[model samples]
Target: MSIEQSWNRITRTLAEHAPATAKELLPPAAEADVRAVEDVLGQRLPVELFEWWTSCGGGLHPVLPHGYIPYRPIGSASAWREWTRRHGDGPQKGSAAGLPGAGWHSRFVPIATDGGGYDLAVDLRPGPLHGCLFAFSHQWGVAYPPEWSSLTAMLGGVADALETGGPVGRYHAETTRGGMLVWKL
Candidate 1:
């Protein structure tokens, strides 16, 4: 399914079974806002990421419950701030998952946050894996192999898990008595 279709499914499920979380979903981002961020970063967003932002800017809280790790979507502004915060911080040195770059690179645009330090980002770096999704742990650095292939894949996995009670990576989707979506390992 298309990213928009997959996201619609997720939102529909959330609205029906997790209204509290659904209510926190942000509206579509303005084109100008997105372009401004791109201008500052000097990088054009991947088409898929731009498409997603046009459909939903981000979320106001950690309402999404099906990422490889806990995360909430972040808007363009938040993404820029995150990129700036980690810019030119030197290469991440440690045993990594054999991924590109020394660790974090300027092209790794964060799209979601765990609210602690970990972020879910799209690798905009020039490579075969460009536009793929990966976990960015401040302590652990960039993860190799990526959590999902793309934003569309991530949303499709989430929508499938929500609809079928299946798994998105290792996460099992659940809804609380308080109408919030939660993921259980």
Candidate 2:
């Protein structure tokens, strides 16, 4: 299936569950938002990325909790802005729930796309097992533990039933750090 198709599936699933914990709803990164993405970096997204995004869907760190946010470079900017305005402070020392909760990185990477929203990227390679990486728009990750291992592995699961063709995964990251890296993959 295409990324949009997969996103529809995920969103449908979430809708059924309704009010899934903040960790359950995976986000969306779509080709429809290509204009928005292009606006952000002032460069067209690589064809490979478009194909990957249309096919692989958004970035979902499988190891994260169900409520964990996925990488969504598309959505309502106000939502993310509101989220930050209300909970801009990272996380506390011990708090686990709510915005600016403990272990979460502060500030989301701002992307200027056509339809503008946020981009949340998750790195799967490297060590330290698995952990939340990108957070833009209304989505961000916490520095908890990993149950998966790598972001690539998580993408693999989403593509298990995917048809042939298209890029292997969704958006890519430009750097590492604990914030939302630019979409390079």
Candidate 3:
């Protein structure tokens, strides 16, 4: 199936499971890890989402809903390596599995970069969930997420937020109600 089709299937299915969860939930320390990330970036992360990430039971990488992608630096460039090193990991193989740690590297993207640039709806992965897009938002120290279905729409939201400097890190996640959606950053 096409990436978009695959993304549609997973997201459609995950929508019914909003407030996405994982196998290994986050410990308080892991929450701190996420906080540290925000601190390092001089920005507050999506708290509720981070809370959800920490709630992972330990397997199946905790992920947001469709049309939302994580923003991270991934590359062999000096600046990228320096960025990763600053994050202080020992260097590890990468995986789309659980949230990565030391040694593991891959920027979380709710949208696909496609070697092109933040196409919020484009799924960069070549695998089954390849077309899945994700994003998050942060504003006034609080993050808002939204429900998205297409890359264009997701990018539009992100662009507006960035332009206004109002909020960021908006992402899609499983909700307790029934499914996931793009919400506060």
Q: Which candidate is the best by lDDT?
A: 1
Q: Which stretches of candidate 3 lie over 4 Å from their true place?
A: 1-29, 57-185
Steric clash pairs (candidate 1):
none
Candidate 1 lDDT over residue span 1-185, tens digit each:
88779888988988998898888887877777667667766777767877777777778656554332322233434654655576445344332332644356666677777766567777776656667877666555544458777788888988998889899887888888988788878
CA shift at 77, candidate 1, in angstroms? 4.1
After superposition on all CA atoms, what RMSD does each candidate show versus the true structure? Answer: 3.7, 13.8, 16.2
Instruction: Please give, for residues 36-75, the per-residue lDDT of candidate 3 as tens digits.
Output: 5555444443333244224321222223323323333221
Clash number by candidate, in order = 0, 17, 63
Q: What is the TM-score of each candidate against the true structure?
A: 0.83, 0.32, 0.25
**After TM-score superposition, what is the CA distance of residue 125 in candidate 1 from its true location, in Å?**
1.1
* Top TM-score model: 1
In the range 8-112, model 2's lDDT, one tens digit per residue, is 543443333322321333343555664464554344544434543454333333212222333345532333455446545655533332222233232233221
TM-score-best of 2 and 3 = 2
Give the number of colliding residue pairs in candidate 1: 0
The 0-to-1 C-alpha lDDT of every candidate, in the order given, reads 0.68, 0.36, 0.32
